[model samples]
Target: MLKRRPLAVLLGLALLSGCATLGEGGASRLDLIRQRRSLRCGVSGKIPGFSYLQTDGSYSGLDVDLCKAFAAAFVPETGAVDYRPLTAPERFTALRTGEIDLLSRNTTMNLSRDAAGGNGLSFAPVVFHDGQGLMVTTDSGINRLEDLQGQSICVGSGTTTEQNLNDAFEARGIAYTPIKYQDLNQVVAGYLQGRCQAMTSDRSQLAAARSGFADPRRHRILEEVLSKEPLAPASVGGDQRLADAMRWVVYALITAEELGITQATVQRRYNEAKRRPELTRLRRFFGIDAGLGEKLGLNDDFVVKVIRATGHYGEIYNRNLGPQSQVPIPRGLNRLGRDGGVMVAPPFQ
Candidate 1:
């Protein structure tokens, strides 16, 4: 016959176990963010049209807008983001360790990254469909990947960009020296300082780098694309609530664009949604109906807040990468599917 432990002792042990779970992976990420009052977002603060720190003392770009969209969905500040500037190697570790609530850095969605055996991140929808390409000085006469044979090329380390560069060169029976850097800024410096004959990155990035040069026309990006880069926002794999909320935040951006809602138009749309019971889709989208935001553990006005903060997906893109913007890459594949591009989202219902 064994004596039973005190009820207080048993309760203490259970609470300690719960606390331990919350210490690492047991707590809900959504709950954590709400409690913390700000979204810890990882971003590459070097890419101009994607995510960059501006001279005016604020972060701005397509990725920054995505971060704002996420923050606006939950926090009251509309753009309550504690931005964590991270390099390629540092980004995934930050997410997996719960250091960040989300990663809005222009990261690619790949099998190794999304798999549990790998980085174990859940990717949001593809926001930008890009391709890797090479950039060379106009004087180099390196018009094609074949022209890069036997030349030293610069690339960002710890990224698929490097692997794709190697695979492309090797498959072509070409040999080149790789000068790698941990940061995109360093890669650009190495290229500009003549450390390499050519540099490679996502073609949009190549355009961005060129736009800032002393003479933009002096550098030219090659027509040869190395690999497809479908860039998206990412989160650590375990939390379903966090994952689901992020998925819809991204979809809300796209859906708003498809439905012709912008920052200026969202308020009126919200009023329309509130007054009308007949517009089922619009009402559900703006959270006028019951069940949309509740399912995600967020307020019903979440999408409204998101749109008011960052407008729609198209607005974010155009603000950073449009014709008047710094890097004007044509929206070949970044447009809505109905607009002849491949971006589409699930219905609000």
Candidate 2:
């Protein structure tokens, strides 16, 4: 207090503090990923169609497919991917600490997350369009949200589901009790044990959970969608190149769907594309000439590798959430733009 610091000294101190807040300054995340030779992806292994740990010690689901796609883009032939199973509360922390290179978990993108500071995290393109919903036993006789005025609901802790449930019920002047658990399995158990009359979560998640019941037909998901949940892959912020690479990897899936490319169709398309180089977009996508992948510091044929590893967006959807899967969800808002849905990819050019 005796002497005032000069403006230059104050400014320099502020600059140093700002740099400290940003964490360690080191090599680019991309270089580290290449050196590691495998993409480490965080996922929620509880949900069936989104991300689940199989009995055979393998991860399977739509989000897992995205992880594989990312790995294929970076690692040479049959790229390597390491799946880290995380819970709702664990995913963001893992991403911020660099424990995981990417988060393919089924996380909802919202204002708070987008504006969150100090963690240096940002969401990529929306991978799945979903909404919050509720499920109850089929014989509960509670057909609507308004009917549950004094009932207990099971929900996952540290998730938007609880807040959304409170908001929706309060807006409707409905009073309810919430039993929160740390994970999906606990929530399901709480619901199944009669501690809660209903379970609330993303509609897709509810469907996935219900599918695990001894008789799935004993439960029914309510039709009312409480909140909009645009799910996407999240990566650490402050690195635009790494973010761009993750974004384009998602876009490639959409673009491949638009182009009618699939695991089965990739070989044929490659041969045809080679014969007719006039298809500029296709050519550039498959690395017939230098293109977006090169610009993103990825292999020129990254899209090809991604497609070969995980198929297109529609194929991933069908394999995980369509008729053949344990949790079959309708592709209402997830279909391609041409099919009356919101999914559309920007042109490769």
Candidate 3:
């Protein structure tokens, strides 16, 4: 027999355990944003046209813009963005360890990432729809996917590209080996060094990589797309409320663009936004009463601020990768609702 501990001691121990769980578990993405007055986003350190550090300590690219938009939506001040660069292997770990509140590094949304036993990361919404493809030296005469048979393909390790390539080749009974590298630079270096027959990744990444080569015309991207990659922002766990806020923030941008509301117009139409019923509903979503921000531990105007700061989804894309930009990624499947693509936003009502 053993003597029982004091009731007060047992109660105190229980409280401490509960507090421990609350400290980490209770901390939501919005909570972190409010406390730190910024949004901590995880991104790749050197992925050009996606997420890259600029000369002035600022992040620039499509992914970086999205993170900035998120921060603006969660907080009015556009400066409330703390960009944390991460690697392919470190992205999910950083989220799970609470080092970053969100992942916006052109990460593809897939089952393994959201699975409980896997990366345990949940997606927000599909921002960009891309596909895997191959890029080879134009002089090499590799023009089609079938040409990759028996060829060594350069690919990044721990990415969906590996499985996508395998699946495509397996279906056609073609045998090929993949030379996986830890970074895109290494993959490009190997391809340049004559170690790889071809390189494969999302077409956008392939394009970005191609632009960085010594001779852009030396390589040409294959026309065949292997898989549907719905690249999206991600967070750890299935926190529905937090995820919903972020998801709709993306939706709001799409909707705003569809409605032709530009960032420059947000101020002039400020009262118009207040008067419009649909806009009013959006305001509440961003926390104009209903204690929504308090519920998420964020400021009331978080979403509003994001919109005001970033314009909308269309603006973000066009600014970073549209026909006007150097990358010029064609908007294939990212068109708005009723525009032949599937970028429909649910009504805030």
Please report the candidate that would top TM-score against the real structure.
2
State the displacement of the C-alpha of residue 122, model 1, in Å, after optimal TM-score superposition.
1.4
TM-score of 1: 0.76
- Model 2 regions lying over 4 Å from their true place: 1-23, 116-118, 135-200, 217-224
Say which candidate scores most in lDDT. 1
Each candidate's TM vs. the true structure?
0.76, 0.78, 0.72
Question: Rank order by lDDT, top first?
Answer: 1, 2, 3
What's the lDDT for residue 39 in model 3?
85
Which parts of model 3 have CA positions greater than 4 angstroms off? 1-27, 77-79, 134-200, 214-224, 275-303
What does candidate 2's lDDT look like per residue over 1-349, in tens digits? 4355687789999868755745766556777788888889899988889899999999999999989988888775548888899988888778776789889999877776766464457788998989888888989998999989899999997657788988999999999999988998999999898898899888897888888799887887887778888999988777777889888889999999999999989988988888997987789888877667789899888988889999999999999988667887767788999998899989887
In candidate 1, what are the lDDT values of residues 250-337, reduced to their tens digit?
A: 9999999999999999998889878888998998899888779999999987999999999999999899888677776667678899
RMSD of candidate 1 to true structure, Å: 7.4
Model 1 lDDT-worst window of ten? 18-27
TM-score of 3: 0.72
List runs of model 1 lying over 4 Å from the truth: 1-25, 134-200, 215-226
Candidate 2 structure lDDT: 0.86
Across residues 180-243, which tens digit of lDDT does each residue of candidate 3 receive? Answer: 9998889989999989989888888887877677877677777667899889999877676678
lDDT of 2 at 220: 79
